[model samples]
Target: MFSEHRQRLVRQLPAGAAALLSANDIMPTNADGTMPYYPNVNVYYLTGLPEEDAMLALFPGHPDPALREILFIKRVDQLFVKWLGRRADKNTASEISGIRTVFYTDEYWAVMKRVLPLCSTIYLHTNEHARSENETQTREDRLLLACKQLYPLHRYERLYPILARQRNAKTPDEIALLRKACEITEKGFRRVLQTIRPGQTGMQVAAEMIHEYMQHNATWAYEPIVAFGADACILHLRANESVGKDGELVLIDAAARHQYYNADLTRSFPLNGRFTPRQRAYYNAVLRVHKQVAQSVKAGILIKDLWKISNNLLLEELVGLGLCTTADISKHGAQHYLNKHCYHNVSHFLGLDLHDTGYHDEPMPAGAVITNEPGIYNEEECIGVRIENDLLVTENGYEDLMKTIPKEAEEIEDLMNR
Candidate 1:
């Protein structure tokens, strides 16, 4: 699978170009302990090897066939394995990455010295996400600086855009992994539904989800959002400290990751297992918009168009609920009026990262996976209703990847009470 990804990237590179990708650095925590190491997504995409200090160099048009693709991994010794377990050996690395040539970290500079001179352009990967605000220097960042200083004549090119474009469309294997992630996430949601009660802390609900994910050999895609009542209005709420009160809605924006592929799902249900009339009204309105957006997903649809569709639907719902008027729409526009109730967009690309790659401006192509999330937050009423599901764009329309997961109001009530 990773070999296919690398080949796709190789096809995009210029004839004389070579690309370099580095795994993530082992970030330091308090004193000597280190934060959990996560391999750089780009590196993992190319090599499928997950370890610190791992690197990949791709020279598609190299003179020596053996040197075209090389993978560098951390060297393992008896002492090292005793503490941190065994790292991928040469054969194991080769099998996983489909790159025959594998070298230890120590040999990387020597190998690069030989490969760099033959390439005119060096493609370096960096954090190119629009929301990326990385302060700590990654191993890739350091490599980029060193390469520029060492070889002044080599033209440097951004590798992120090329990879992002390729990664936007899911391959069959990638789709399978994403489905597995969603299935794991469904287990977490079901468990939480069964465990949740009025007195349970938001942290407890998050713990139930995390426990389910870990049991399935998966992990959290992002920080789980377990917001009860008003906290759901805070889009990025991560401090799961509040208690769920009776009659309040508990919004869970959580997902599970399988083999680095992710599934993002959000479900809001009554803490006491039955939505009040007002809560059901808000929830159903959001669900209606969410369903419409999911149905509208198809090839050649621009992401902005989805936002327009969602905004229009939300505005209508708001007007019907007497939250806004036609006068408000005319003065502030439908989007502005809808923003008073729902502040965020209804969709985002979903895959490896929660907010995965793909340009929002570009037309969504077949195989692109996205989230259809329409939400309404009424601060005065202390109600926040969000319903999210993963959709895979198809030639005809879209397939709801999370269709099996229960999202209906009655279904949630029954599951919770059961």
Candidate 2:
């Protein structure tokens, strides 16, 4: 998948265009210390380069073949390596990434200037995708502006949309890694099921998941969300506390990452190891929608249409539960303030990013992996329920990646009790 992605990005360029991608900067937490380093997804996708401040440039279809793909990495000094820990040397970077051409950071401009004149249009990368709304700044953002000023006449284009389109469908190897990630998530989910009880704290479950993840050479794709009762009503809740009372439903939305591929799963169980009547009703409704969505997830199904189907099912279930009626849905739109307790959309694209980048308007094709999670939350009832499974779209049908994870109330209760 990584090698194919590198070639695909290179293919985007014409005979004489240069494409450049930058690594993520070491973000500061406070004071002199810095937060943990997060690799840029694009760089990781192309070259599997995880270190900070690395740069990759691909001058595809060049006249001289020596300048196809050039990688610039941080120079490793003994003192810096001792303090900041080991950084990749040029030879090490080349060996690991399978990119033969590499140089020190000091030579980036010199190399770019040598090849810049050979290419007419410079494909400058920026976080211009819709998901970049939350980004305040980026290393590529600064470099793009500076490059444009330095060479005012060069034609510059945004690479986010281009890369996003290419990354929508997974390659065979990508699907394998994604499946491995889901397997790790299954292990963690099973661990929680055996360990959870009425008095257990949310953080304890989080700790257990991390322990399992470390044991299996995996890590949480994102922060594991362990919310109980009213806490689950607040989607994206992160307060891992033991304040949840017995008999409340504990909602756990967690996943693990394997080699940069991601898996996402959400399961809600009871604190007392058995679902109450209210919880069971809502949980079953959501599960029905989840199954229906997975069943319908074949080639040529638009994501928006899938959401509409899931929402309609939820509306029917709401009416069944006496929470809302057909007239209520008719009078108010889906954004009906009354139904705000209804959690966010059913599911999203799952891969490198938790909310992976992909085209939603077009029908999802085979070779794509997505989540089918249906959830309902009621603050007044102090109950929230969600059931999720990772799905891989296939030519014949869809396969549930997290199939082994228990979602049936009986199975969940049995595991929790045991």
Q: Which candidate is the best by lDDT?
A: 1
How much is the lDDT of residue 135 in candidate 2?
Answer: 52
Give the Å error, residue 180, model 2: 1.1
lDDT of each: 0.90, 0.82
Once superposed on the true structure, which residue ranges of model 1 sit more than 4 Å away at CA? none
Model 1: per-residue lDDT, tens digit, 115-183?
999999999988889888889877888999999999989999999899888999999999999999999
Model 2 per-residue lDDT tens digits across residues 345-369: 7878878887877777987778778
- Superposed Cα deviation of residue 17, candidate 1 (Å): 1.1
- lDDT for position 359 in model 2: 76
Say which candidate scores most in TM-score.
1
In model 2, the runs with Cα more than 4 Å from the true position are: 337-339
